[model samples]
Target: MKQSLLAARYFNTTAEEAMDGLIASATPRQYLISVQDGTSLRVRIWSEIGLEEAQMGELLDWLRGVQGDIRSIQSGSTNAHDHASVVEKWVAERHGIADLFLEQLDPTTSSKADMEPELSLGVLGGRTVMISTNTLMFSRLQEGVFGLSIAQRGSYLIEQLRRA
Candidate 1:
């Protein structure tokens, strides 16, 4: 199995300091990096080739254990599209697909647009997952930030999952 580092982890340090830790951990393999302001914690973004299932597990473990400065903020996955679809499907199954679609179309319904007028977040793989700033699980991936870095909010949510 293959997996990517899809996460919104919270660090108790500054963005620069947290990035230094990430760089140290991902050494020898050159992964792209990006940084931005966060609501309570700093946000960083990066991309690299996927890792094997076991390798991904090991890496996340090290990050949560030895790398005590980092905290997993939300559930992450090797693929964003798949995770978002799963979240959507879970919602649809419970609420009915037609009701879900109607809720999305309802303008009075609160959304990310109502809160921040200048934020656009999306991920592209086999498909696109548009991230909103609202409080939904998937939307919370890009909450409380005007920039493009994807992150999540929830106390110690990352530590619980221990995988990304």
Candidate 2:
């Protein structure tokens, strides 16, 4: 399969260091970084023709693999139960979609943003599935030190499939 790297970097470090760190850790075929307040980086590990292709639907199927319920943080102290249920329902419905990817953007250092979740959808194939939200969450966690940068390194597989 032809693979390209997608990466995003943040922080004061050089893009080379961040890219190297990601490649060294994950060893993926492709990499892409969405750096905030810094230059981004990308690398292609493999090249080939006629790789197995996928449509938007197929991408969605992969996303659905990690679908599940999420407990929401309490809202007000007096109506905590009601708010929790409401938030839980909202989250569940949001994830119920066929082809969606969600990432809780939380920076370890701290930031004003309330760690809002980032979501994306793959919509080419007939069988759409949601990608692993946990994976996206973890990726964001790793980039926490870099501020609010968004990284979609593992999504290369999905992107390749889409191209196919």
* CA shift of 112, model 1, Å: 10
Which portions of model 2 miss their true places by more than 4 Å? 1-54, 69-136, 140-164
lDDT tens digits by residue: candidate 1, 10-40: 2212223323443444322222222133212
Residue-level lDDT of model 2, residues 72-97, one tens digit each, is 21112223234323222222333223
lDDT of each: 0.26, 0.27
lDDT of candidate model 2 versus the reference:
0.27
For candidate 1, what is the TM-score?
0.18
In terms of lDDT, the best-performing candidate is 2
What's the C-alpha lDDT at position 98 in model 2? 30
Off by over 4 Å in 1: 1-45, 67-164
Q: Count the backbone clashes (under 3 Å) in each candidate.
A: 1, 30
